[model samples]
Target chain A: MKKNRLGEFQELVLMTVIVLQDDAYGVEIQRDLEERLKKRLSVGAIQTALKRMVEKGFLTSEFGEATQKRGGKRKRIYSATPYAHQVLREMRDLRAQLWDAMPRLGTSQA
Target chain B: MKKNRLGEFQELVLMTVIVLQDDAYGVEIQRDLEERLKKRLSVGAIQTALKRMVEKGFLTSEFGEATQKRGGKRKRIYSATPYAHQVLREMRDLRAQLWDAMPRLGTSQA
Candidate 1:
């Protein structure tokens, strides 16, 4: 099978989904990313990216039970698929390979 | 300048544009990417991505002189800017650092 490539934002978003665990949803994912990356993100953009990821099979989403607090609007929770996890591992490994080839990264600047 | 993040496809396209150098036009870029990646890409998608990259300042485009080969349609040539080059370097360095942190990557797996 061919490997799917993740965009920079896609990878970060995927990692965030993992970090958020079962609580991953549009609003929560956006909030978590904002907090961690210290970057401003629009809800619509996050939703669009999330939808795209889902279509690409990197993520799976399901509607959570509606809560009275939000007037019965269910949240669409997201999680990384097994494929996503494998892709992340591969990316990490590829990055690892490139890093190991460089000896002066963490050393003194000379 | 704020560090801009690259998407997987965006990075691949940027790298292809860089590889194509002065000959980097839409058709050549599309063809080059298809040849190197062994994937089919639409002209519209490539053009859209290229336009987006230009908007993000990761790429710059200029109209090349219309050649008789293309029936007088000037090709839009793309090139990575200094900012793009810096981002690529940073990404490479980041990958390198991550790789070096993995001690067992290149070692015998037991």
Candidate 2:
């Protein structure tokens, strides 16, 4: 498998997990992504991305404490793995390098 | 087609084209990616990505001046389309926002 490569949606979902920190979970992630992107997202789409990232070792999830408000249902909290953070940093650096290399006209035209 | 979404390899190739500016072409891009990434790349792989991005409208290509070194073969120079630049900026901003929201410890562990 190709390692350290993230699809756009996977990157977005992984970043959201990091943003939400301890509260990162399915419902919350979907809501937050919708709010931040100003676009509607299906729960299934979010779950698919979450599952794929988990398999890629970019994320880890653990069930939260059971809540009485939800009739003993536990939300699975997600967190970014070290690998995910490393990839994100490397990606940012690569883009910065490219941007720095761009000629004045290249950016101006864009 | 998903708009404004770039795969990891596609993103790398697009960035390389921007870095090379007017000089961007298949051979130069492949060489640059290999050097920066410290990984060997096949011409076929690079061509495939270039073709894909061109079809996606993230890139545009034009034939450069025929060179004596190439025996009259014109190198097809690649450039980032405005859409590509826009997508790159959006991706950067999204990542920055997520990184900002991360707790200090989140980055520390990574």
Q: Give me the candidate number with maximum DockQ.
A: 2
Task: Please compute DockQ, using alpha carbons, for every candidate against the native two-chain complex.
Answer: 0.12, 0.61
Task: For candidate 1, give the docking quality class from DockQ.
Answer: incorrect
RMSD of 2: 3.2
Q: Which candidate is the best by TM-score?
A: 2
Interface C-alpha RMSD, model 1: 7.0
lDDT of 1 by residue, A1-110 (tens): 64455777777777777767778898988997787556789999788888888988999999888888847689999988888878878766654443343333237932
The sequence of per-residue lDDT tens digits that candidate 2 reaches over residues A1-110 is 56656887888888889888888999999999998888999999999999999988999999998777846579999999888888888877877777777666635555
**Model 2: how far residue B52 lies from native, Å:** 2.4
For candidate 2 chain B, which ten residues in a row score worst on lDDT? Answer: B101-110
For B1-110, candidate 2 gives per-residue lDDT tens digits of 55545787888888889888888999989999899888899999889989999988999899989888746688999988888888888877877787787666635564
Query: What tens digits encode model 1's per-residue C-alpha lDDT throughout B1-110?
Result: 75466777777677778767778899998997786556799998788888888988999999888887847688899998888777867766654543343333236942
